[model samples]
Target chain A: GIQVEQSPPDLILQEGANSTLRCNFSDSVNNLQWFHQNPWGQLINLFYIPSGTKQNGRLSATTVATERYSLLYISSSQTTDSGVYFCAVNGFSGGYNKLIFGAGTRLAVHP
Target chain B: EPEVTQTPSHQVTQMGQEVILRCVPISNHLYFYWYRQILGQKVEFLVSFYNNEISEKSEIFDDQFSVERPDGSNFTLKIRSTKLEDSAMYFCASRTRRTSNEKLFFGSGTQLSVL
Candidate 1:
């Protein structure tokens, strides 16, 4: 089983600031995804980057497959960005995909 | 964009009681999965279903749990006898294909409280 660890378990930022969260996996992965869990418990998909880099609005992510690590960047953060950000990866064991998630980085943006 | 939909946004059940959580995945998706997140914990995979059978399941998915497609559109997870530890946010997810590039979509999740 692959292990996924996220850094800066807790983060606090002022609105309009920028932040970066990191995720390190123990093994090579075939798929990786980033999600933002809102206060209402909705897991909103942010990016599906198994490798390389991708950006979506104020959020962007980059995964270095060879290094087995990924980074999530939140630019010009807003108060609404307060929540838990998770990074999940699929190692494709037994010929199927099962996403293993990191504990997540809890972010709080204050006005 | 199509998404996975789960019913009974919240459920409360007494220990030892039977509980069923239902989901309607994106119409054309072929792979379906159930994952649970205990409060303050990372989301954990429970099971994966394809072709009307379970393809893989984690240790957390034991004899007490079962999954059924039941029909073309609905996927259900049944806990034969719920326990206090069973309380958590259960999420249903689906993907259009088996390819690693296919993105997986998740439902809002059902909050289950076992007393």
Candidate 2:
């Protein structure tokens, strides 16, 4: 099984600031996704960047497959951005597209 | 955009009771999955279904659990005997294809509380 580890398990930022979260996987992956779990516990899909980079509004993600790592950038963060950000990947070993998730980086933005 | 929908947003059951959580994935999606997140824990995969059969399941998905696509539109997860540890937020997800580029969408999730 592949291992996914996220850094800065806890993050605190003031509104309008920027932040970056990192995820490192122990093996190559065929699919990668970023999600934001809101206070209500809804897992909102942010990006599906298995490799390369993608941007969606104030959120952007870049995955360097060769390095087996991904970075999520939140620009001009707002108070509503407070939640847990997760990075999940489907490794080749998991033939059925099973996504293994990291523990997540809990983000808090204060006004 | 179409999205996955789950019913009974919240469920409460006594230990040893039988419980079923239902989900309606996007009509066009072919792959369906069930994931669970215990409080303060990472989301863990339970099982994946395609073509009306389970493709893969994690160790956590034991004899106590079962999945069924009883109809063309509904996917259900049945717990024969619920336990206190079974309490968690269960999420249902779907993807249009098995290709790596196909994005997976998740439902709002059902909060289960086993007493």
Candidate 3:
């Protein structure tokens, strides 16, 4: 089993500020995803980046698979962005891949 | 977009009682999974189902827990005897492809509270 670690266990940012969240896995992964668990407890898919960089609106993510690390960037943050951000990876297991989640980074974007 | 749907958004059950949580995964999805998140804890994987059978399960899934795709469209998780620790937000997820790179779509979740 692969161990997933997320940094900055807790973060508080003012609206319009920028922040970066990092995730590091112990082993190589074939798939990785970023999720936002909103205040309502719905896990919203942010990005499924196995490698390279991808941008979606004010949110973007970069995964350096060789380095076994991924970074999620949030720019011009808003109050709506307040929630727990999670990073999950699909590491090989029993001839298949299982999604393993990391302890989320709780972000509070105050206006 | 198609989404996974879960029933009884919140449930309250007495300890030792049998409880069943239901979900309807995306119609085209071939892989289905159940994950749980205890309050203030990380989301944990419980089981994954494909080809109408379980493909992989975590230690969290024990003899008291079981999963079934009773019908072509409905997926369910059953607990023979619920315990106080069983209370958590249970999520149902689905993915269209069996490959590793495919993204997963998760249902809102069922908040089960065992007393």
Candidate 4:
């Protein structure tokens, strides 16, 4: 099984601030996805980048497959962005068949 | 857009009682999964079902746990006998079978509290 590790277990930011969250995996991943768990406990798929960079609204993500790492960037953050961000990965082996999640990075955006 | 939906947003049950969590996955998705998260803990995978049978499952999904795709739209996770530790947020997810990769659509989740 591949291990997914996310950094900065907790973060607090004021509105308009920016932050970057990182995830590292122990093995090669066939696919990688990022999710935001809002205050209401709804997991929204933010990014599905197996490799390369992508952006949506105020959020962007980049996955360096060769390095086994990925990053999620929140730009000019708003209070609505407050929630837990999760990075999940599926490796090239049997472990890659199912997505395994990280411990999550909890973000609190204060107005 | 179409999304996964779960019923009984919150549930409180007694230990040792049978409880079934229901979900309606995206109409076109082929892979279904059940996951749980204890408060302040990492989300854990329980089981994965495909083709009307379980394809893989974690150790946490033991004898007491079972999954069923009883119909075209409904997927269910049944816990035969619950335990106090079972109290957590349960999430249901589904993904379509794309040739390369697919993103999973997750339901809002069920907050189950076992007493």
Please list, in the order the candidates appear, how each scores on TM-score for chain B only: 0.98, 0.98, 0.98, 0.95
lDDT of 2 by residue, A12-80 (tens): 999999999999999998889999999989999999899999998998999999999999999999999
Query: What is the interface RMSD, in angstroms, for predicted model 2?
Result: 1.3
DockQ of 1: 0.73
Chain A TM-scores in order: 0.97, 0.98, 0.97, 0.97
lDDT of candidate 2 over B8-105, digit per residue (tens) = 89999999999999999999888999999999999999999999899989999999999999989999999999999999999999998986456789
* Chain A vs. native, model 3, TM-score: 0.97
Judge candidate 2 against the unseen true structure and give its global Cα lDDT, from 0 to 1. 0.94
Off by over 4 Å in 4: B98-100
* Local accuracy of candidate 1 as per-residue lDDT tens digits, B7-115: 8899999999999999999998999999999999999999999999998899999999999999799999999999999999999999988765668899999999999
Fnat of candidates, each listed? 0.70, 0.68, 0.62, 0.48
What digit string (tens of lDDT, one per residue) describes model 3 on residues B1-115?
A: 6789999899999999999999999998989999999999999999999998889898999999999999899999999999999999999999988887788889999999999
What interface RMSD does each of the candidate structures achieve? 1.4, 1.3, 1.3, 2.5
Q: List the residue pairs that clash in candidate 4.
A: A91-A96
DockQ, structure candidate 2: 0.72
Model 1 chain B worst lDDT run, 10 consecutive residues: B95-104
Model 3 local distance difference test score = 0.94
Q: Is candidate 1 or candidate 4 better by lDDT?
A: 1
- Please give, for residues A1-111, the per-residue lDDT of candidate 4 as tens digits: 899999899999999999999999999888899999988877888999999999999999999999999999999999999999999988777732678899999999999
* Candidate 4: CAPRI quality band: medium
